[model samples]
Target: MVRISGEAVELANEGSLPAQEVPQTSITRSQAVKLYISHALSTWNARGYEFATILFTASAYPDTLVAAAIRMTIVYFAMILFSSVVGRWVQKSPNRLRTLLATIFVNRASVLAGAFFWLLILSQEDLIGSEGRFSLAKNDTLKHILFVVAMSFGIIERLSASGNLISMERDWVVTVAAPSGRPYDLTHLNAVMRRIDLVCKLISPILISVVISALDSVRIGVVYTALTSMVSIPIEAISARRVWDDNPSLRVPKEVPPEGETPPLQSGTMSWRTQLRQYLHDSKMYFSTTVWIPSMALAMLYFNVITWRATFITYLINVGYSLNTITIARTIGSLFEISSTVATPRGVEYLGKSYRSVPQDEHESEVGLVSGEDSQSVRDTRTLVGLQRFGLWGFTWQVFNTAPVVVALFAITAPRVQDGGINVFASRMVDRAADYTLPAPPVGWSIVLFSFLAISRFGVWIYDLTTQQLTQTLVPSHQRSSFAGVETSMMNIVQLFAGGAAIAYPKTDQFVYLASASFVVVVLSWLMYASWVYRQRGHLVHWEKLGQGLFVGGR
Candidate 1:
């Protein structure tokens, strides 16, 4: 007779999968506090930005704000050169805290020193000007110097913040999910994203507008931004620990990344060529050098000129609306639309788990097998497949995809900028109150432009949300920090060039140019929608769910 003993019971239990495995990572709460100081170093918002706006509108020269641009360029150049060096210097070293401490010192401590010295400078200026012994020239120089120093610290911190966050996010995500099994299913992970999006959508627009306005104002904006970072960074860093539970995978860095390896390639928008380029390339500046390689080698490569037009138009619409509203709104909206599993815990349980893994034989479906042994691999692979295909949008979001187009826009308009600029044609008419004794023609023109912009904001809001999500989801988690940071750099770079173009831009027929661009952008939308469908056409599994089981519902 077969007799079961305590040893048999122990053996049987040992054979079973874990009830729950929660893992904790080494990126501890203390380290998280230090990591965020980089934000203060990296952001370089100049004081008196409103003043600069007025000056730029009235004057002919590159203002002190442009100096802020130069400083940003220098900082990034240093960051690009030094990131790996910094990465190495701190890699597995106890002195990683030293780097964080140094950034903090430069950002927070140096401000006190500069403030004291600048107060002396201001005292001298006051005495000299009061005595009628000073020129506006002396005061301007001192003011500019003080402003640049404060902003430089800000820029350095912002750069460090981006790198710091990326590092934390990567490590934290892996640690949190380590207990689930061989492969983590993102569908199970991102389901909670919907609530986040909903909350963000409703809350962000208002909060962001306040944030931007406060950031734009005097003295208060800088302090507010620094304080916000202090709070937000710590929270973000700590939240990662919750994901990993009961897994042996949680601890210090190991030989392997948690998500494991990429599966062998099947069909994807990413060609072998693009993959090779992305893998081997350093300094994402080189990313674009290869997009043309495939096009040239292929017999038929069609250009989507309309898509390009639509994107620019979309971008215009985005900024045309209250940028503060769009920035926060879009961020929250994108967060919400992301798969609930990837975003929330309750979302995962509700959307992902089968109430009964063993379904009725008559109701047995392809999904029923998701709980089986072999089924894990298939489900995991499908999620990865779905995740990886997002690289198409990723491909578009990267430097190689966007640089040439922006450079071309700059090149086209760079020659015509004249001194004092074209007065932002629409702004010229709108800034003056309608009742404030303006010419009849000007009043009428202002009304039309404002009306147009008001109607356009809604469309712009939608596009902004879509594009932000596309950027976030399309990228691999490992590379997203640098990639997202690069977008900011691209915006700054474009604006710098655009500033010069704006200076030279003549006022003649300004509305004509604006209207034409806007019209072209709207018309191109349908075509862009078509291209999205075209790229998605061949994927057999990518289908819209038509019935109850087809649609994913979150908790």
Candidate 2:
């Protein structure tokens, strides 16, 4: 006797069906693959552009190393400011997709403009007199303006890339399904994306090198920029279109909670002060999760180490290593990264299973699962899993992975070592030749150093994957964006301070010592915090079988 509309009938039928038996309206497998490809291409283009910009800046400036570092600091600072504003706007705006698309367009336009300016400057080399050239290199005012404009564009490009990543994550949550008609597991999806990302990283540097070689002239770098932009921008637009068309409901503005209900944190209607407090509170909660703060600290240290490596790369180029050779080395490193990426998911899974029992039928909660009254035991299991996964020894291994670079830098710059007395591994490897150019180190030493770099790179990649998985597990759905934004902002602030320190003491020894001391302090602090966590939760720990299935003839 009840009057039911067609929609109500559909809903009633849907509710009657079992979860797995119900058909889902989600993205097709082909569409998902295409989106992944687009993401990789976008990352490639951005990295290529950055590489070109660094080389261009170094070639144009006299104090190349220090200038590039300063320029990088400015870019980081700009991205921090821009992302904070834009992220808030996206969260609050009714038209998120449109705003995202418009931002992408603006980022591409800025890249084009920056490329044009670089071309203009490079092409005018013959026309500029000696005085003009000197001014171009040494005039602080002109140099500052040029770096600011160029880096601002870079910041915009990075922000746009981040927006795309967030969109992709959201799309997967809302619209993606497993090929077997089951809910998508974030761990599996992240593994696939990481492998693709590694493959992209492997190919992008070689492609960039080829482009640079083909162009031959710095002025022609603009052509490469335009080409990459054309490829990436169109793909992004198409992906956005597909997302909207395939998931029409995503376009609908999210409704506010009823007036009587408790308002969600970070709601658009909240006062600015309220929002700030919420952000801080959310950040604290997120970082307080077992081992997250230290894991994050190590990640930040790795990022800071990269800037130091960039400065080192500039030094190498100044002292006669061709840019091509450096690019080739990086490409080789990426090959190793592919292996690391492939192993990470399995490693995390093994550790999780070994340390604690993860529910096999819990894919729904795997994406944005949070601790609840009924799930408190599960949360405890996950907390113990994290503790065992990245306890004191894990943190130490991560620190050691990247410590060799600092050691190598110290050996190269220390006065005693510079005098060529240390002979255990050929002090000449660190010594400057008579011509003031650094000589190629012995092949054995080169192998050791490159091995260190490769291992460090692998460790960092694993850490990144682990942090992401933990974040997905710990953060609730409603607070994900707020937490993500706060974490990102905090990382940038830390990097800015680190970058400022690097700029202040541009000398190799000074930089290495400061970096080493900081790294040690972070690792020790993490170890202490980890000890405290272990004490609080140690009683929960239990032994579990390993290699049981394989040995027992089980599938």
Model 1: residues >4 Å from true position, as ranges? Answer: 1-138, 178-217, 220-250, 254-281, 284-373, 385-555
For each candidate, how many residue pairs have backbone atoms clashing (under 3 Å)?
A: 47, 0
Cα lDDT of model 2 overall?
0.53
Poorest 10 consecutive residues by lDDT, candidate 1: 294-303
lDDT of 1 at 540: 22
Write candidate 1's Cα lDDT for 104-154 as tens digits: 344334434333333333334333355543223346566556645644544
RMSD of each: 13.6, 9.0
lDDT of 2 by residue, 363-436 (tens): 21331122232343343344325423534333454568556765664554443233345532233345545333
Assess candidate 2 and give its TM-score to the true structure.
Answer: 0.72
**Candidate of highest TM-score:** 2
Q: lDDT at 495 for candidate 2? A: 72
Each model's lDDT comes to: 0.33, 0.53
Top lDDT model: 2
Every model's TM-score: 0.44, 0.72
